[model samples]
Each structure stands twice: as C-alpha cells, then as structure tokens.
Target chain A: MVCIDCSSSSATARLLPMSHQHVALRRFLRGPLNLRPPCCSFPRTFKTLTVHSSASPSPVLAASITSEASAKVIDGKSVAKQIRDEITTEVSRMKDAIGVIPGLAVILVGDRKDSATYVRNKKKSCESVGINSYEVRLPEDSTEQELLKFISDFNDDPSVHGILVQLPLPSHMNEQNILNAVCIEKDVDGFHPLNIGRLAMRGREPTFVPCTPKGCIELLHRYGISIKGKRAVVIGRSNIVGMPAALLLQREDATVSIVHSRTKNPEEFTRQADIIISAVGQPNMVRGSWIKPGAVIIDVGINPVEDPKSPRGYRLVGDVCYEEASKIASAITPVPGGVGPMTIAMLLSNTFISAKRIHNFR
Target chain B: MVCIDCSSSSATARLLPMSHQHVALRRFLRGPLNLRPPCCSFPRTFKTLTVHSSASPSPVLAASITSEASAKVIDGKSVAKQIRDEITTEVSRMKDAIGVIPGLAVILVGDRKDSATYVRNKKKSCESVGINSYEVRLPEDSTEQELLKFISDFNDDPSVHGILVQLPLPSHMNEQNILNAVCIEKDVDGFHPLNIGRLAMRGREPTFVPCTPKGCIELLHRYGISIKGKRAVVIGRSNIVGMPAALLLQREDATVSIVHSRTKNPEEFTRQADIIISAVGQPNMVRGSWIKPGAVIIDVGINPVEDPKSPRGYRLVGDVCYEEASKIASAITPVPGGVGPMTIAMLLSNTFISAKRIHNFR
Candidate 1:
C-alpha cells in the first residue's frame, strides 16, 4: 500500500495495480452502499486480469480509484505551526499598535508528571505564539484557599486575558471549587460549567471550546472535509473528547452517533460511518474491518506501548490499527503527529480569540 | 383508529376489526424494520386482532402494551408541582427559622408577546412556590448600560438567589454582553456561556441547565423511560432547545441523532427512532408518518397559530402534527398541557436548586 504525505499538495493521487484497485474499489463500494447507483452495471467476470501494469495512470483516475486504499495523513503538526504563525502575526500587530499583549496565567496545584508535562507544553506554546505566560507552581500540600487566592488575583489583573488550572489537583482540594473560583471572562480553558453548558446547547457558542475536540474539528476544516450531511461516529463518551467531539460534529450538521463501553455491536455501527473519531484510549482497537473503506479516521488516543525497535524503549499507538486501517481508510491521522500538536495549537488560538474579544480587536 | 390511554390501570384487550388491526400493526412493523425478527419461523400471521373503539382502552391490556413500549410518560406537571410544593415548604420553613427567603429577579427587555407570557408564567410559578419574584420591565429602546446596571445590582444583591433575563432581548442590545453581566452563581436560566460550556464537556456538570430542555429530560426521567441504548432524535438545532435536549439524551446513554433543516429525508431518520423530541417551533412540521408506532413523542414547540374558535383568537400548536402523531405514537405530550407547564416547573425547580446550593442545604 502507498502512503500519501498530506503535507504536500503534489501527493493528491498515486497509482496501483488493477487487481489491487478492483479489490479496494469493491471494499469502498460496500461501505458506502447508499452512495452507489442502484442500477449501475459492472463487469461481472474478471479472469485474474491486470490492467496496464506498465502504463502510468492519470492523477484523476488514481485519485478516484485508489484513494481509499492509501491513507491521506492529516498533517496536524504542520497545520498547528501554520495556525501558531497566524496567531503570532496577529499578536505582534496588536502589540505594535496598541502596546498590549495577551497574557495567560496557568496555576499548577500538584507535581503529577503528566500535569507538569502538559503545563510545560502549554507555556512553550504560549511563548512560540508571542503571548506572555505566567506560571504558578504550588506544592501538592497547598490549601484550596491558596489556589483560590491566586485565581482571585488573576481575575482582577487586567493584563491576564486567560487563566487555566492544570488538572489533577490534590485530593483534598475540590476540583470543581477551584475551577469555579476563576472568573468566567478569564476562564480560557472553557472548563467552567457555564461555558460548557453553552457549548453543549444550540445557538450558543462558548467563549472557548475545550482544546482537544476543537483541534479535531479544526483539522477537518483545514483538510476541507465536508461535515454536513455526513454520518460521524465518535467512539467514547468522555466529556473532554468523545462527547464534545460528537456535539461539535452535530453542530457542523453531521448526523453523529456515539458508542461507549455500554454500546452493543460498536463496530457494526462504526462500519456504517462516513467519518470515525476514536478516542477510547484502547490501542489499535479499531481494526481495518471496523472502518468503512473510504471513511475519514480521526484517532485521538495517545497511548504508549512496548516497541523494542524504538529508541525510547516504547512507542506511541493510537486507538486505530494504523497499518491495517491505512490499507482501507481514505484518510487517517497518525498517533504522534495527529491530534497531539493540534491541541496546543487550539489552546493558543483560544487565547488569541479571548484577547481579541476582550480588547475588541478583529 | 383505536387510541390506548396507557395512563389508566384497568383497560383490557379486545379484538378489533381484522382490517384495522392488520393495517396498524403492519405500519408499525414497516416503520421500524430493524425491530422485526429475522427468521421465517417468527409469527408471519397474527393469531388474533385486538382493537378498542374508545379513546381510553381496557386497562389490563394497556399496562401490558405500555410495558412493551419500554418507557413511561414523564409526567412533568405532577413532578413540577411536587418540586414546587417542596420549595414552598422550605421557603416557609426558612422564613420561620431564619427570617430569610430566597428571591428571584427577572429582567424583561422588550414586549415580545412570547417573552412577556413566559415572564408572567415564571412570576406566577415563583409565587406558587413561595419564592419572591422581582420584575424589571425595561422599555424596548433601553440601552446596554441600562441593562448592565440592573444586572450589576442583581449580582450584588444577597437575597436574589436566581436571575433570569427573558430571551430574544431587543435586537439593539448585545445579547452576549447583557448575559455575561449576570453573576455566574445567580444565573438560574443557565444561558451564560460559562455554564453552557461546562454542561457540554465531560466530568463537569453545570450549575444550572437551560430550563426548557432540562424540563423535557426531567419529564423523561420521571416517566421511567430507559434512555440507555434507545434511538433518540431531537428535531431542531436551536441552542435553547434542540441542542441541549440532544446532549441530555446522550448523557443518559442514548444513541442520539440530531435532525435539522440541513438534514435530508428527516422523516426517514425520525421513523427509525424510539424517542422523538421536536423543538423546531414550526407548527405541525413533524408528520405522523415520521413517528415510529409505539414511540414516545415530546413536543417542545409552543407556536401560536390563528384559531377563530378560541377566546384568545389564537391557539398553541407544537412542532409535531398532534392529531396525526397521537394515533401513531404510543405516548405523547400535548402542546398546551405538555412542555409549556414543564418549562415553568423546571424554572421553579432550578430556583429551589439554586437556593439549596447557595445555602448548602443538602
């Protein structure tokens, strides 16, 4: 199977043998049977025939016939970089003319390794995008009042356009209480109940969408995938990923279905989808057979599995079986380079949006 | 056509005319083909045909058939009344014990006839529940600052446990700006972006949900409907109704589908659902054919269509074709006595919830 490098526009099409093409096209047809002409005639018999093994196929035919066989990688890293660049330019313009810069204050309550890594990445993202980052690292034993006090101060600070609290606070400190203490205007993570409620409801747009799901939708839009009238299946029901992703898809006019642990015959439903977003965190759980041949796949799970050949002694694997899925899917997002980078990019974008809304900047 | 009042307890089975029974059952089977048994050994012909001529069917058969329908009607009015009674008792108890009572402040910007009626109903609901209702009816030409000042006062007032601004604020006033001014804790209407965002994301619950949709779901819960694994469709994408209703259904573990204006063949989708919540506000938009026989219908639209026979000169109609839907749907909520009463009940319930949460009365 050929792999298409999505970062380059020239990789729009590629050729494969006729035998390979026939099998792939047949598989694609079965998946989207509703789109096939009911009365179309096809050659009922092919005697192990290979069409023009030596002849070069035109890009248009290659795109039409073989597109479903090879995965068109969603280059989220490049897209994220492009987004950061756009935000950087906008931030610089705001600073140069108005003598103002967007500021984000992040408060970390404990020293969990994952939380620390996330906070560091967020700060780095802020720096790269020309936004000022304020970090407050409190010990695990810090009282809830201490965190609330910092939030109160940040709330009053006019320079702070956004405030985010790293997750997994000390068990003694109520997470909801700490979160609700942040002023709504500065709650850029959009975790506030009010913001989330608005995001979930129709006709209302949240001031900030949760970073990860927003990133997935952004990837779709950047790739020019039409969401309207499509059947989208989101695997998982977590608030941060699956639920929000489903809501966002529906908002964009897709008929969405969510499958969770309680779902019966998840694959049966998934195989009927035009787009599949799997964020269930089960490595390689979505196999080739689970996907519709031409379905666009968005793998949101970032899990580390043992791989002896890897330099780090472990390698990242997504919820989708990349090798098998690539053979059947029209497009697929790779685990490491897919949803990961786009998350921080969306965070920066949200910060920029919050700044613009606060300062009345277009 | 025969009607079964499943709410009754004594209705018994009766044999109907062969033609009518065959037609109705055949239509039901065709409407939801997936529910049909796949094997030929399954009953190809009915041994008996049962029908009733009265609006209220025999009670014993109604109970048996209703159980097969898999959900009980969520009697919204009764539940709302229970909640209001509880609130009334609590308010009187608080007044006697501490000489303090919870108050609700309502702001009405313009005389949109619908908004006025809603506000009036809310005020009456508040009185019925023994909560103080404060009203501020502003002129249509009032500026943003005027509304802002009122919100500021309400926000600072300790007695006001809840604040609701009637929706469809005059076109001139920035809706978001006025909404954002209400303090988050006092936002009982749950229109604040922060509250909505929280409701949408996982592991987070909103302080308050938008009243009408919340009411609709509450009705389902009270009626003992099993949302899990059920195919639920919300017809409308309005932020206030359609969107939130879908989210609530999803939260309850239902496989949800949203059908909006952009959806092609909406009836084809609706006819496959076990539950339909229509909130498009277009009178009689959902036809009887769109309903799966024995499915439950919750019509949230309160459209005022001209009616020469009514004293008010206009009668309320729902998004569903009631006369037609009543024949097909096993259970359905009527336009006037259904979702409307539930909305006010939810508002009162929300106010009580706010008071309890504020005072830590749990």
Candidate 2:
C-alpha cells in the first residue's frame, strides 16, 4: 500500500513546474515507452499518438517545439483546488448568514496505517475548507457494537452534518451492517444503498455522490468536456469507484459499458469508447493502442510500482500506461496529480453541502 | 396500450399448437421477412438463417426437413408456468405448516381499464395458487392522502405479505411519495430506492427484484444458459426493466454494457454481445443484423404493431424483429409468449418469497 500520490504527498507534487514535466514526459514517451508490450494480447488499432515536430540541432531545436502533447492534461489537482476554494467561500457565507459551521465526523476502527492516514488527511482537508471536524478512533479489537454506537451518536449530533466511516474495517466486523447503520442524511461518503439506488435512478438524486467518482465527473465538467452521447467504458465494477463512475457517466447520457477482469478482449470495448475511466488496480493494463483517437481518459487507479530510481523505491502510476495514453487521448488525468487530490476535496464539498441541506441554508 | 399477449390472454394462447406456428413462422420469415430492412440503417452481418432442406416437391420433402430452426425459442410462457407451479407448492406447504396463507394486496388508484384488468388477472392468479388476495380500488380523483392511507393500512396488515400499488396514478399524485409510503418489508414491486440501491451493490440482495427483469434472468437460468464471463448488452436503460436487468447480469459476473437512445452505432455493441436484453419500446428496433451468431436474446419490449389479419387489428411484438432475430440468435424469447406472462408470474413468486421470509419458513 504505497500511497505515493495520496493526499498528504500531493501538495508537494502540485508545486512542481507542470509544463516542464509534460515536455520531458512527451520526450520519454517517444523513446523507451514504445518498447513495453501490452499487459494482455488483444487486437488494437494502429493509430499511434504522434508528437509533431522536426528533428534539429540544438541551435534550431527551439524552432520545432510548437505542438502540445496529444492529450490535454486534465490537471485534476488544479481543478480540485478551484472546487475547494469555491467550497471555502460557500462555507464562509453560510457561517456568516446562518451562524452554522459545517461539521464532518469520521470513525476509524482499525490500526491500518493507510486508513489512519486517510482519516488524518480528511480532517486536514475539512479544516482547510472552514468545516468543523470530529474524529473517533477505536482499537482493531473493538466490537461492531462499539462502532455502531459511535455512528448513532454522530447521527444524533446536530453539530455533525456528515459522517464517514473509513473503509476496510476489521474482518471480524460485518462491514455492511456497520455502514448501513449510518443515517442516510449524514452519509456524506454516500455508501448507503438508498443513496446509491437514488443515484442509479433517472429522476432521483442521492444525498451525496461518492467522492472519487464525483470528482472525476467534476473534472470533465470544469474542462468543458462533453459527456452526452459519448461511448464511455468504465474498467472496473467496484462499489465505491467504478460502479458509481459508470452510473454518473450514464446519468450524463453517455452510453456506458463496464469491462472487468472477466471480460475478454478488453481492448475491443476500450477502442470503441469516446471516454475511458480505468479504476482497475492493474498498472499499465490499458495500452496506448487500446484508446480511440482523441478519446478522453480518466485513470482512477493509483497503483504504486517498483522503481529503484525513485527515492522511495516505488513510484505511483495509474491503471493506464500514462506515457502511451497521453500520446493518444484527447484529454487525460495524470496519476499523482489527477484523481487523488479530488477525493478529499469532494469530501469537504459534500460536508458543506450536507450542512447547508440539514440547516436549510440553501 | 394494446396488450395483445398480456397475462390474461396468454392462458388461451398457450393452448395453440406452438410448434406448428414456429414452422409457419420459419416459412414466413424465409420469404417476406427478408424484404424488411432494418428499422434504423446500421451495419449488419451477412449470415442468413437458412433452413437446410432439399428441393423435393412431395415424395422426398418429408425426409428433407430435418434441420431445426437456427435459434431455439426460449419458451418464457412455459418457464413462467413452471415457476407458478413451484410457487403454488410453496404456498400450500407454508399454509399447511403455519396456518398462514401468503397474501398480496394491490391498490388500484384510478379508473384506467387496463389497470383494472391487470388487478383482476392478478387476483385470479392468486386464487389459482391458493394465495389470499386483497384489493383496494380508489376513484380517479382520489387525493394522494387517500392512497397513502390505504398503503399505510396494508403496511400494518400482517396478513399482507406483499403490497403493490398500480402505476400511473392520477396526474395530481406524486408517484415517488406514494410509492415510498409502502413499508419496504412488503415492497414486492422492489421499486423502493433502498431496494434498488441494494440490488446495485455487490454482496447485497434486495428484498425483491422488479418482476420483469427478475423473470428475464430466471428464464435464462431455467434454460441452462451460462451468464458468467459472457458479454451482455442491455438495450434501453429504463429503471424498471433495462437498468435492473443490466445490474442483475453484472451481479452474475457477465460484463454488462448499457445501450440507450444516445448510443451511437449500437449495432457495433450488440453484434459483439453473447447475450442481449432489449427493452426499448421501439418495435422491430433490433434486427437480425444487430445480433451475434448464437447470441441469447431476451426481448422485454412488448410494442404493439398493426396487424389487420388479427381480430384486434393490431398485434403485440417485441423490440426485436422476431422473424429476423430468431434466425440469428442461438435462443430468443418470443414477443407475445415471452416476458409478458413472466412479469405476473414473478410477481406471484415475489409475493410467496416475502411471505416465507416473514414467517422464517424454509
């Protein structure tokens, strides 16, 4: 569980000169990236992501670098920052007008470091957005009843507008029972089946859309990418990310297909997609040839691969081969700077929304 | 509006010689069906459904007709009958053991003749299976509160194991509000958001699946069709049929794709599918060309088409051009004798299942 681009580390990553890396990435993509074979043998279109330029000496090199990368970088970090700013303004206004500060309560019941880190980052995100944050940490051996009691208390607390339970609870506990115990109104994480059901329905709205998928859609909207009438492929069917992502894409009127591990010739569907969102945690599963020309790509998988060159001995990559996909996709999200930052941003935004809804402030 | 093969009429239609019509249909398909082009201009495969036979006039003609139709008829009518029998046995056993009869209460809140007929047929079906039936009829102008009151009463009635509110309430009523009023325990229709949400999630089962989609999957299972690892394309995304049908297919480990009106080049998707379920209301929308060789098709669409040859002046047809699809598909459910009766049969099954779940009966 090397969370190389998790929220805690994304701040430093964001400060790097983006244009410089994009140039280097393009050059690297043109060179050794071509050597890597696709993860699975499948038929793919021969349309390669071509970077248009002329080879020239150092003196004339400056004259040839005019075209941008094949795909526009989605820069989710920047978009997420913009949303957080918007949420911050809204949170301040609500507090000034209604004297109500939005609050989010998070419950963690295990000693998993990844879970703890997620909770800490979420709290930090809440504070940054002017939302009140509450935390309840129980030992790994705690009973399910203990977790339920905390949820019940949070459900009753007027100060808490949103409640989140860090996932991957202890194996001894029934995760469904614990999560269902959260009040639907306070389910900012949107794990409740009622919320999911509403999200899937045409005329209904959920209390909150799950953070990761919501962020993915938000990036597409902010970038003015049209989703309606697009053939989108969502590669994964996990309850939290892939399933809801497909539902959101469909809600926007995209003809959506879900390709999972069981699917044969995954490239056949991928090549037909106008937009591809890969949340399957297999690094570099989607090769360059699998993409339709100028298709948008949103890679949700944050997989860490061994990289002895990096200081940590591992570097983060998405489910797609970024070097290859960037050459072909019309627009794409980068691994570390892409969907990672948006998840917490969405959490804060959901808290503010829940507070407004609960207080009748909007 | 013209329910040509609705549950009420299917009882008599079942007495007709099914094989004789199939032979006639095959002959008719070989002649005039070829003249009918696809409803929408799309690319199609050239594989024709040719019946293998020799050119014998009379003497050898009897021996020449050995090859069967390319696709096997799914026979949803017979399967629905088998399910009804199973429910009947279960109802009897439960009643004998616990002195409790399975009860279904249907509330019809309008003067729509079709709704009234549906209720009558349902009541008749209940009586045939020895399940107690309860009915509440309200005027077309009845207030929403009046309907809610009836729903509340049924919710409190312990004898009622299933509660169904006839759809298309008077325009003045809020359908969502009224439907939500039914206690989820007795929500045999499975329209509640909670039930739908549970159905969408992995490792969660709904109290009831919507009748029609459940029946579609039931037919496939009874026919010994394998869904796991298959590519299934669900045409149409209506919450009642298409959406849940896709969810159900995905639950069974088939990689599912949803093609709706907005989908461009739908034939490309359908042609690759191993199983297709078409619920779009367009008559003859899915052509033989759209089907893959040996694909299993479940046609949920019951559109009415003009037929001066019939007594009704029009006849019920599925979204598929049956003459064309039956030739290409490995197996298909017929328009009239297919998903229509299965809807009511599944309703009975759900009612019985609810009663058993309530009483903790095996």
DockQ of each candidate relative to the true complex: 0.28, 0.33
Say which docking band candidate 2 falls in. Answer: acceptable
Q: What is the per-residue lDDT of model 2 for residues B1-362, given as tens digits with 9 covering 90 to 100?
A: 22222211111212112233222232221111212222322223333334313211011101111123478999988998888888889899998899999999999987766667778889999998888999999999999989999999999999999998887677899989999999999999888999999999876899999998999999999999999979899987877777899999998989899987677656656767789998766566676656666789998866555666568656667767676667667899997899888988999999999999999999
User: Residue B3: error of model 1 in Å?
Assistant: 13
Where does model 1 exceed 4 Å of error? A1-68, A84-165, A177-188, A201-205, A308-313, A351-362, B1-102, B107-120, B136-160, B305-315, B357-362
Local accuracy of candidate 1 as per-residue lDDT tens digits, B243-332: 778777876767777777666556645665778997765556675556666678998866555545558665666666565566567778
TM agreement with the true structure for every prediction: 0.72, 0.83
Q: Which pairs clash (backbone N, Cα, C closer than 3 Å) in model 2?
A: none
Relative to the true structure, how large is the alpha-carbon lDDT of every model? Answer: 0.68, 0.75
**lDDT of candidate 1 over A138-254, digit per residue (tens):** 999999989999999999988988898877577899988998898878887766666666666554677788788898999999999999978788887765677778878987878
Judging by DockQ against the true structure, name the best candidate. Answer: 2
